[model samples]
Target: MRVAIVHDELMRKGGAEQVVLTMLKAFPNADLFTLAYNPEGTYPEYKNYKINTSKLQFLSRSVKWMQRLYFPLGVWAMKSLKVHGYDVVLISNTHSAKYVDIDNDALVFIYTYTPFRLAWEPTSYSQYVESRGVYRWVFDKVINYLREIDRKEAQKGDFYLGMTKETAQRIRDAYQVEDVTIIAPDVKTVNFKLSDKEKEYYLVVSRLEYYKKTDLAIEAFNELGLPLIVVGSGTKADELKRLAKPNIQFRSGLTSEELADLYANCKALIFPQYEDYGITPLEAIASGRPVIAYERGGVLETMIPYRGDASKATAVFFKEQTIESLKGAIELFQSLNFDPEFIKAHAEKFDEYVFIDKIKQFVTDKYRKSRQKSSPKPKLASEKRINS
Candidate 1:
């Protein structure tokens, strides 16, 4: 079957993009569609596919700013695209990809990382804080308008695939939609390898965003006087660096191999954010390293408590997201002896093979059902005459 895959944007290589790549692999002949495509030295595999971008590409250098403004516009543009011939359309969305227009008869599968949390939790640290100005007012108005549009689009989709159980619950609450499936994110096992060589420093492998809580890790590491190596960069990088202590080291933009090495070698991976479904912690665990994470959201679902003998957990969790809380957890982990084999075992559950199998099954089942409903069967002449 011909397939069309839609994504929020192809501006950067992140967890969402990884999911899209997995979908592409599942349907090799599928054409990719996105709002923007700023390759900016991304995976060579992306170049092999037919990626169709929206008119937002006209922004050129101002692409980032345009994303904030043209989000709804991108959705509207999808209606103009000639995807009617495609048997299935799969959307890998963190944002507006859910808003794509498709045939009512087409098999539409929506993979949601989060149900637009920025719209629901506007005051959350992850959201863009705007100052009192014309731009701020306009931004708020636009965001509110787009949020309603997003909700409408979400309700129209054939099925919703959530990255985690927590995300499924959130989507149900936010959109009042019931047909949702929980599909955990996949990790590329080949990218991460187990290492015997240990490092004293803990690793924080995430975008240096406010919502990521990189600041929390920095503060905790500084207070504990522990060596902390941060790998990745984002909007908050410069400000976070200013707050960094002598013990904290920041490295921006590393290849997947380099990141996997860091994950394998570090004493433990520190994930301070309450993420939807963090791939980094899983990667660290797959590399036979335990994680130190906030005890909420997807982490609660994935990580087992480090305390109970009956409990089988791959990581230690902090009750609070504060620096003090994280520091205490780090110290506790340092004092305890964690089983690396157990950690690796837990991570194995989210291996690429499992994810691919589950997704393939879901798509195949849906496609079969769609065909069964649409296919015309041979009719009896008597029945036909009666109908006439």
Candidate 2:
């Protein structure tokens, strides 16, 4: 069977891109398609694959600026894919890969990271547009147009998968699709090691973006005067650095080995974002470290919150996004003792191997059923006798 894997874009490294990488491992022989590709911008493992890109690749050369055109051009790019001959077309989508044109017989499964955030979650991204008057006006117009296109494209998929219940709900709200299945993304737990000796510094492993709320960690850590290691780079990198105190140190461009070392030795991870389904917190837990996270979004589903027992708790939850709330959580975390082996065990449940097994089984079952439906049935013995 010919299998095709389509991703929205391969311009940067994040949870969405990680899902695509995991899919490639699951379907090693499948042909890979994308709207664009940037070797230096994304994970290096992609360079090993034979990647097919859409016409938008010319404009997607610039990893930073090209994303502004992704929603519109990404839709056009997906529509341009030659997925007709494939038996199964699996899309790792967040922005616009769901629009891929394919034959009616081809099974299309969309593993949605979320509905296009800019089109559906305007309030979360208001900071990006609110400052520029003319830009904001144009953005609102484009978003309105994209919403209709997104909803229409959503109907083309044979099945939909979401990373968490929160994202599943968002998919239903944005696309009016009822049967969204939850398939949580996973971490390569084997890459991380459980450590009993931890350094004094707290950790924050997130893209430094406005919506990610990395600034909350900076402010909270500044007041606490604790050593903090911020492990990511983004558009807000400079501004976040400016906001941070001397105790906060920033690092980026880390290899998997280097990152795992950081995760293992940190006192705990400070996660402030209301994420779709966070990988960093799981990565931290896999390293036998606890997490202090916001009490909303996917973290609620992943992190075992600290009530009175630390033995079963993997994290301490802050109710609000404010710095004070996170600071309070940190203080509360200091009083609790989490079991490293227990935390590590909890993270192992969402290992990459689990995702691979579930996805492969789902595809096999679906493909088998699809073939059963389409294949012509043999005549019964009585019918053959009658014809003779």
Candidate 3:
């Protein structure tokens, strides 16, 4: 059957993009549909695919207006996507892709990283609009308007694949749709390896953003006077670097091998972000490094605790997104003894092969059921007698 795939954006390479890459492997012939596409901005591997973009993509090729008005415009552009001939339209996104239009018989299977991250989290949305201008209220209205559209679009899906149990509940809360299946994203076990010798520094692999609470990590490390490496680039990169102490190092444009080396040698990962399904902490744990993270979102689903009532936890949690809490968690992490082999073993559950297998089975099962329902047939008495 002809299949189509939609993703939130191809603007950059991140966890979501990696998930799309996996999807492409699962459905090799599927055409990629998106509101925008930038071969340079996204993963170079995506250039191998036949990516069909909306008109908005061509219009914003030079100016990149999508970065500013992505929600409203992206939602509008995606609604124009025609997914009629395909038997299944598998969509992946933190928010936008679900709005893509589908024909009556086309089955929509959504692999949501989160149910519109900015809409569900007030602080994040506020940070987004606050960064824009004095007309925060006007922006708020616009977001709310987009949210209503997003909510309706969500129900159009035949099924929802939540990255975690917490995210499944969050999906229900966001869209009031209970037909969700749990499917975890995976890590490249071969890419990350434990180091023979570890350094006396912390690490954070997050896109620099206010909502990520990266500022807290920087502030805490500044006081600790320990080497902390922040590996990522974003709009907040300059501001975060400016606030960081001399001990804090910023590394961007590092290759996967280089990143794995950094991961192998770091004391532990300091994860301050509240993500839907964070892949970085798992990657660190896979590299045999413990993680000290805020206790919220997808981390709660993936990370294990070393303290009371814990069961093979690969990481520890800070109660709040504050310097004091993180500093205390760091102190707590130092006092514990985490087995590197144990951490790596726990991380194996999220290997890329496992995730791909699950996706194949899920989509295949869904496709079979949809086809069966559409062509409703009963077993003949002769067939039943022969079976009996």
| Candidate 2 residue spans exceeding 4 A from truth | 126-134, 374-388
Clashing pairs in 1: none
The residue-level lDDT of candidate 1 at 130 comes to: 48
Per-residue alpha-carbon lDDT of model 1 for 1-388, expressed as tens digits? 7788988778776788888888877777888887767776345568878788766655633445655556555556544444456788888876667655565556778888987756766655444574468866876886697677667677545678897788998888877878799889888776777777856789998877768888889887778888999988777889999999989999866777787778888999999998888888888888878899899888777677787551366788899988789888888888777777777888888888888889888988988886877565634432211110
Give the Cα-based TM-score of candidate 2 against the true structure. 0.93
The lDDT for every candidate, in the order shown, is: 0.77, 0.85, 0.81
Give the top-scoring candidate (TM-score).
2
Candidate 2 vs candidate 3: the lDDT winner is 2
Residue 106 lDDT in model 3? 70
Runs in model 3 lying further than 4 Å from the true structure? 61-64, 126-134, 308-312, 374-388
Candidate 1 has a TM-score of: 0.90
* Candidate 2: tens digits of C-alpha lDDT, residues 1-388: 6899988888887888888889988999999988889998898999999998888888878666577666666567767776668999898998767766766667778899889888888777746556578877877888899897788777767788998888998999987878898889988898899876746899999888879898889998899999999999888999999999999999999998999999999999999988888999999999999999999888988889999999999999999999889889999898888899999999999999999999988987988887878555544433211110
Candidate 3 weakest ten by summed lDDT: 379-388
Best-matching candidate per lDDT: 2
Q: How many clashes does each candidate structure show, in the order listed?
A: 0, 0, 2
- Can you write out model 3's per-residue Cα lDDT over 295-371, one digit (the tens) per residue? 98888878887675333668889988888999999988777778888899999989988988999889988898767
Instruction: Return the TM-score for each candidate structure.
Output: 0.90, 0.93, 0.91
